[model samples]
Target: MSPQRLRDDLVKQTKIDVLTADQAKDNEAHMHTVSRSFLTDTITVPTPEMMSYAALSSLGDAVYHEAATDALEKHMARLTGKEAALFLPSGTMSNQIAIRTHLTQPPHSIVCDARTHIHKYEAGGAAFHSQAAVIPIHPANGHHITLEEIIHNADLTSDIHFALTKLIVLENTLNGTIFPQDEILRIAKFAKENDLKLHLDGARIWHVAAELAIPLEELVSPFDSVSICFSKGLGAPIGTCLMGPAAFINKARWLRKLFGGGMRQTGFLSASAAYAVSNNFEKLFHVHELTRRIEKGLIELGAEILSPAETCMVFYDPAPLGLEYAEILERAAKLPDPITLGGSRLVCHIQTSDQAVADFLALISQLKEEKKAEGWVPPEKTHVNGNGVIRDVYVRPKAIH
Candidate 1:
C-alpha cells in the first residue's frame, strides 16, 4: 500500500468526533443527577472553574517530575506534615504502593480493620504486589479498632507457621465513623515499639478534619504514611497523594512506574487536585451538615440510623418504616427530578444539593404513609450488627424507552 493511502486510513480512524449534538444537554442532566446522588462521593464531577484553572497548568511530563505535579506533592507533604508525597491515579494504587514500599520480605502481614478499603476493596493488591497476608481484625467496640485488639490479634511472633505483622493500616472515617484520635495514638505508639510501619487509608480523612475541627497535620501525624484521596469528598476528578518520608516516597515513585501507574503530562490532573485541596476542603462542612440533616430526617421518619452522620456519610435501615431499600430506591428513581441512591450508605458530597436531601426525606415520608395505609407492619426491632450485613445496595439501570 502507498504511504499516503496508509496515512489517510489512520487519520480517518483517529478523526472521530466524540461529542454528540446533545452532549452539553446530557452533561447538564448529569450534573443534576450528581447533585442528588446519595451513592458515593467519587461520583462528584469536576467544576468548570476547576477545569479552567487546571487547563492553564504547565504541560510537562510527570515521569520527569512535572512542575505542577511536584508542587502538588510538596503541598500535600506540607499539609500533612510529612517529608514528601507521591501523586498517583487512585487511592488503591497509593495504598498498595505504600504497602509494597513498607514491607521488604516474605512471611509478612499487614494488620487493619476488617472493613478497610485496603483489605476488602483493593482486590487483594497487598497479596499481589507485596506478597503479604492481611490480618483483618473486627473492632470489638463496633466503632474503631483499639490498641488492645491489635496486640491480641497481631502475629508479632517469629513463628515459622505464620507471617509476622510488619505493618499496621488504619482508615479514618471508616463507613463514615471517625477513628478515635486517642485510640490511634495508642496504636501508633504500640506499632512504633514493635518496629511495625503504620499507614493510613485517609481517603475520607478530609471529612474527619472538617467534622472534628482537627488540623490535617495533627490528624495524620501518627502514621508513618497516609494516603489521602482528592477524588472522594474533595470533588477532584482523579488523584490520590501518598505522603511519607522523603526516601520512602522516592522508592514509591519507582514502584509506581513498575505498577504501570506512571503517567505523562499530569500537570492538569495535579492542578485539579490542588484546586480541590485549596477550595473544596472547606465545603466538606456543608457536606457533613447535609449528611446530618439526612440522619435527622431518617430518625424522625422512623428509619433506623445504623450509622450516625459522624462525617459525610450515614447508613440507615428503612425497616423501621415498614419499608425496604428497594421500595425507596424504586420511588427515588421515579421522582420528577430523579434522585440516585445506593441503598444503606447515603454519602453526601460537595455537589450534593440541600434540595436533594429534602427530596429523599420527602420520598421516605410518602412511602411510610403508603405502607401504613396498606396495613404494613413494622418488623420486630433487633440489634442490627454494624459489621454483619453489606450496607451499600447496587442498582442497575432500566431500559429507557
Candidate 2:
C-alpha cells in the first residue's frame, strides 16, 4: 500500500483522534502520551509565562551572537569538559559534522555499533556528507559493542585496499541501557593507541549521567567529540550541541554552515536550550523512575521486557499475551484521549506523569482481559508481522534541519 493509503486505512480502522499541539494542550488532562521522548504538548509548546521570560532575555543577532549562541556553546563545553562546543540545529547535524571534521579527507571509515543512530537512522548522511564509510559491528545482545568487537573491526592495517579507520563512535543509552563506563574507557584507550579519533553520540547522555549518579563531565571525558541533544529527554523543543577541542569545533562550525545549519537570530531557540540545561537536566531522574514504573506494570501484564529499564525508555514485546499489534493499537486509538502507537518503544519524559503511566497500563490490562474473554485470534497476517516481534521505539519530534 502507498504511504498515504496506509495512513488513511489506519485512521479509518482505528478511529484514532489525531491532535495538533494546540489541541493536545487544550486536552492535556485527558491525554496520556507514554511514547514521547520529551515533555508533552503542555510543556513543549511555549506558554505566555515562557514568552515573558524570553522577552526579558537577550535577543539573538543576525549572525551567531555572543549572548545566546556563543554562551550556550561555552556552557555546553564547560559541562562536558571539552575545550569548545558548537550549537547546531539537530543531533544528526552534530554527529555528521563531527564525522566530516574527523575524517577530513575521504577514503576514511568510522566504526560503530550497527544500531548507532548514524548507521541506522541518519539516512546514510555520513556517506553523503563526509564521503566516509561506516563499519558497523553488531553486538550479540544488540545493545552495545564490546572493546573486543571494536578491535576486531578497527582494521588499522595500512593496506590501501581498505578505508582508513579514522574514528570510533559509541552511543550512550543506545537502547535505553547505559553503555558501561569501563567499556568506554577501554575503547578510548584503544582509539588512542591506534591513533583514531573517538566520538560519542550522547544524544540522551543526560539520562545516563542521571542514572549513574555521576557528573556529566565524567561520562563524556573519554571521547574526543560528543553530541548531546537538548530536544531529547532534556525537554528543549530543539537544538543539539557538539563539544570537542577548540580547533576541532572551529572546523565543525564551518561544516555546520556548509550543511546549511547556520541560523540567524537563533537565541530564541538557544534560550530554550539554555533553560533545558539549567532546569530540565536534573528532572531526568524522575522520568527514569516513571519509566521503571511503566516497565513493572508491563511485566505484570505478561509482556516481555526486552531490556532493563535504565533511562526513560522501555522496550518490550507484547506478543506473549496473545495480543495482536493491530488490536492493541486500535484499542489505544479508542481511548478517551487516544495515543498513537509509537512503534514498539515506550519512552517517558518530563511531561509523562505517574497517572499517565497507570492509565496506559490499565488500558493494556483491559485489552488483554477482553481478548481472553472473547477468544480473539489475531489475524494470520497483520501490519506488524513482517516488522519483527521486538519493537525499538525512540521518540524524536520531527524538526527541520
Q: Give me the candidate number with maximum lDDT.
A: 1
In angstroms, the error of model 1 at 135 is: 0.8
| C-alpha positional error of residue 38 in candidate 1 after TM-score superposition, expressed in Å | 0.3
lDDT of 2: 0.79
Candidate of highest TM-score: 1
Worst ten in a row by lDDT for model 1: 392-401
Give the per-residue lDDT digits (tens) of candidate 1, residues 41-160: 999998889999999999999998599999999889999999999999999999999999999989899999988899988899999999999999998788888999999999988789
Tens digit of per-residue lDDT, candidate 2, span 255-279:
8888998878777778888877787
Question: lDDT scores for all predictions?
Answer: 0.90, 0.79
- Per-residue error for 7 in candidate 2, Å, reads 43
Point out where model 1 deviates above 4 Å: 1-6, 380-401
